[model samples]
Target: MARFKTKHTEWLLSNMAITVSSLLSSNPKPLTSRPVGRPPIEYVNAGPRQKRKLASDLAVHQGHNTSLLVHAAAVSAEKSNEEDTALVLKNIYLTPSDHNKVRKNLFTQKTDSVRLTEDEAFFEFVLKIAYRLKLKKWQVRDENGKKEMAKQKNTIQKKMWNAMALHVDKPKQNGNGNTNDGNTARRAFAKPKLLAEILGLDENLIAYFNSILIAISCHLPIDPTQFKKYCQKTVTLYMSLYPWFPMSATVHKVLMHGYQIIEASILPLGVLGENASEARNKYYKSDRRLHARKSTRQKNMEDVFHRAMDSSDPLVSSIYLAKRLGQQNKLPLPADVIELLESPNFLYPCNMDNNNNAPVFDANNSDSDSDSENPFTIEIDVEDDF
Candidate 1:
């Protein structure tokens, strides 16, 4: 499993490197590999000395972006492991690479208003802004700019001067026309953190800062489209890092607490597959009428059942409670348990008779034919997804 996850990350990194390398090149290569080294940039396109700066700019930007994302994933994994979170390791693998290819196709797509179906545009814009700021800190910001920064104070002039720290981002939405994020620039600043433990700050804090920065930026301003992208990045990062699957209950809580300030509604990014409907219905061992009627996953029956028992979902909570209590060493679940498993919907009951007692699932078996270990996950044809 660890090996699989490592290779998965490697592929993502490699593909990104390829894309960036292409963009930086005077003549981008066809999607093919040559024996490695640095791909030669022997021929220079005619331009000012500024042309020489491309390699330096690309390196610094990639380093900063890659470092933050890598650390975020690491911190997430460490925290979840310490606390026994649910959605661990499973999200580390890619759905397949074509999802990224589809991304370029969607760039520049716009509408009179935001499209509910495809909404990553806003956060992408924010990222473009942040990247430009980092680049500015490298490419520009001379001694004079430093002096100007040193002079900043709370007066209105200071505000204007501070706001002069413009970086690459989408242009302001003027009455004339729209501007693309990559082609425009926006005011930005680099606030130095005094804390010794940067990542040590709460993960939610990291996400909030990301959102607040976007909210204040004139380019992104407080638009719903941009806000949704911010939420998606946070949620995706959490899913990729945490050990537990964010069930509807937990998902509701996390999004609720995180977005409370904004008072926004978000579409769910549920695990996909044909059995998603079934998983939603009968997977967990929780009550219904008392709280709200809810569903469950079909796979990872034990895990879902456990989640239900822990939450208020009442449906099969008691049954699960009984099984776990009696679990240490048991065989044929008493007749009642057998009847429950035999119920038309419930498939894999705890293998009561298997005194042989096998471990339920292993991470390495992600593609194993037997079955998926994640109860909440859908069995989509990964190829189709890609």
Candidate 2:
């Protein structure tokens, strides 16, 4: 009965944090082989300082190449009297010779070519450029660098776990018999603000992370236009920072289609989130164990069903609610969260109370006629069929 739709968003963010941390702690392996005709860019084994200088040089070269392409496109457009910018740009970017070669190799009359879609063809072209540039694979850490990476990874994980401890209760076991203190889903929900400071992440990356947290939050109302703009900026920043990090299907959907989905929903996206249903799972488990009959499987199911129905009954629920105490004061929402919200007033009359004292339901205040009767008691009849 565990719903995964909402949980997946949280998991994605948690996994992303882990992936980024791991990547930052170690070097990545080269993703593609060198293109046969292209000369290898030297300084593969260079230190950080040298790499930074080379990267700057590469940026300058790329800018120069882009300028040349733009100039060529403008000249070609004028000479051919082509008013269609799309066609002109395509023609300029993909030379006739390159197009012919791609058509022959990837889009032929053969069945193999028939299976290759435009997307795949484009990816192949990208792979070629990546190969020429000796770009690293995002996911693969260097095997030889594991010793140093392990040390760094431990340090990072320690910091992350410590930061997580402030918001979430430490789990007894992480399902592998180890007392791994942090729970990914809980951490995602908590959205610790110190992640950037703890990990020493770039400000741009920190902004991207914050945006992602806002996007996935079940409590916040999302504005489609604002979400779209934020999505685009975050995606661009992430790609610029780590071009080798292949966008997973989940991330692709969130970045490309999330705003559309939000716009299509009639209710606030937060209201439609799975938090309420997920919270009921604990109640379900407890009810099954403590209240449900064990005489027969059918009887056990019926008992559980009846108990659930009783709990959900509006009249019954209202009585319990009347006797229930007010909830503990909640912490104020972060500034970024408020900024992304469509209506900040939705969270008006913010709970600024620093008091730790919670209101308690007093038995003397009960409206029921029977003073001795306990409203919280559940009466279960045990069948002695055995």
Candidate 3:
């Protein structure tokens, strides 16, 4: 029908516009991996090539395999001065294929069964929690599953979807530039506290999900010390409750080694995370397709270098040249950069003042001795209200 055709055309245009906007944006590194929590239904049901591309992006991001622009420049410089006249090296010293090999190795090398790609681990975790909670009406399913193919929808899953509103649609401000919604309504309901409150989860379930959320979030602005303690307690409880579950392995791993992994890295997690790599991969793929030939690699490399040089600020160019020429000591970090790094507000929040003191339990039910011993016991009325 004409009406159906018009609707389809509108959908196509909207999608094309979105794609173009995404393409124009720089692929900055993420605070966490792409497909951070779980694989979307569409991604799960995608064909082989689509799935492979998703996996490839995850691998690239997980490994934090950035193109070392400085190193690439060094390679190009050295190759140009080679004695062999016939052997002209147009590309940077490191090939794009070399980066791909490293990314491939990241997926293949890890032996941990819990490492079922970025989204898979997240999906498994969500499924396990949902199963335990008796939220099976709209279950997370595999691509090939009958349930996944079925069109019938469930209400419980709809409620859960509302609870997981991570990216909220903020109300548009008027010409006066004042927020229409108050702070209470504007507050993110996706947080564990709100999710527990809105979804009417029990105290035990609240504590369990709270811990899982803390462990999973790589860059929450909470105090690291309190976060570590909270993570330790929650992970211990979750593992005790669901020791046999595969996602428990992920929680267990986080308990043992997750905190130290970030500390060991040279750059911030956001800088090295997969977002940047995947973005470059997308650009390269599109450009390579257009310029398909034996010499394409060399041509592309030259293009990348030219773009990098052209876009770079004068100060950045000087610093790059200085570092490349082994005069890095001559250029000290800018005062603003140093000040920003040293500022307490940069990435982490200040430590909790009363972290050692446990929160008060129900004032009505507890004896003095009981209250003193287990201060973390939450009030029963909180559950009653929920």
Candidate 4:
């Protein structure tokens, strides 16, 4: 069973990597073996180490090693001494060549920020603006064609930037069909309350926007069904307000794929999330900016290995070092127990039967009369055409 879960996770990660590569590249290629050495690169901005680190970081942010399933499998496989299972779970044995191919597919040159979904990126934009963070800090130019640093002090500090942006998104145009150059442009920023009222941003709209933020933030319990319903409701509400409202591809994909990930698996959003990967990218960017000659291939390799094998968590570090030292040390807890600890859904009665042969499903025994019927079972009817 552990082997099956591990293999299933690997397959999902592989497929996700491939799908993302196909989307980003015009011509995606299958992963293949190649001679070991520094992989080919078009630029010499930094040495091979920086290139590898950058590539790996990009791949991770795009859901390559971001799968909780893979991590769980790795943990589970370390506990089980079964030779066949060990062989199947030996992913760390991947040659550098194959690993490079996986990274290439999972990331692309076009990627500026790691926010793959539209909604996530949108929220980030709003929050950054609200916090008065300078945009395009890497670049040294603004629209006014001046050398001035782009740091504008926002007098009005608002917590709900997304909600506010909606009110001011559509500006009134002059007779020439362009925004008024002088006073009109400044007035838009002056009276925000009036504009909010004009745009129908009442108490209800503000509440809805707040609710949407809470839903996507994943600060609440990791319930995919509830999350999916929230997403659908928010989208529907937005559409009703403005029928021609544009939605990002990422938003659409979230409704279709994001929630189902939780529904069909034991992993929680926090475990399978992009926060760690995103934070890692930020670290890389900061490190690179601090110096020019810092990104070496050996440095990249050492950093990754250290992060995996020498974690800050004592339990993780202990188990990883034990596995590395080839000692038959018992895991902190059994692999199955680890899964149960990480996921609350598994503790439910539906999955907690102790019987070895608890008939998979008693189809013949219709027990609608029983009060202990499967409360989880849900059904809905749909019409072919309305």
Per-model TM against the reference = 0.16, 0.46, 0.33, 0.29
Residues 162-273, candidate 2, lDDT per residue (tens digit)?
7765322233443322232224433433443465455444455555554455455546667888878888887787678657657655567767787898789877666776
Whichever of 2 and 3 has more lDDT, that candidate is 2
lDDT of each: 0.38, 0.56, 0.44, 0.44
> Against the true structure, candidate 3 has what lDDT?
0.44
Q: Write the per-residue lDDT of candidate 3 for residues 141-235, one digit (tens) a residue.
A: 56544343232223333554466532222233443321212222223222446545543444454444434332333322223354356557666
lDDT of 2 at 167: 27
Model 1: per-residue lDDT, tens digit, 167-278?
3222455633333331222112122121102212233534344333333321211334444455566666655543232324333343434345334423212122233355
Candidate 4 clash total? 2
Q: How far is candidate 4 from the true structure (C-alpha RMSD, Å)?
A: 35.8
Q: Ranking under lDDT, best-scoring first? A: 2, 4, 3, 1
Which number leads on lDDT?
A: 2
Better of 3 and 4 by TM-score: 3
User: How many clashing residue pairs, candidate 3?
Assistant: 1
Candidate 3: which pairs clash?
61-274
- Alpha-carbon RMSD to native, per candidate: 33.8, 31.3, 34.3, 35.8
Candidate 4 stretches with Cα past 4 Å from truth are: 1-206, 219-221, 255-258, 278-304, 312-386
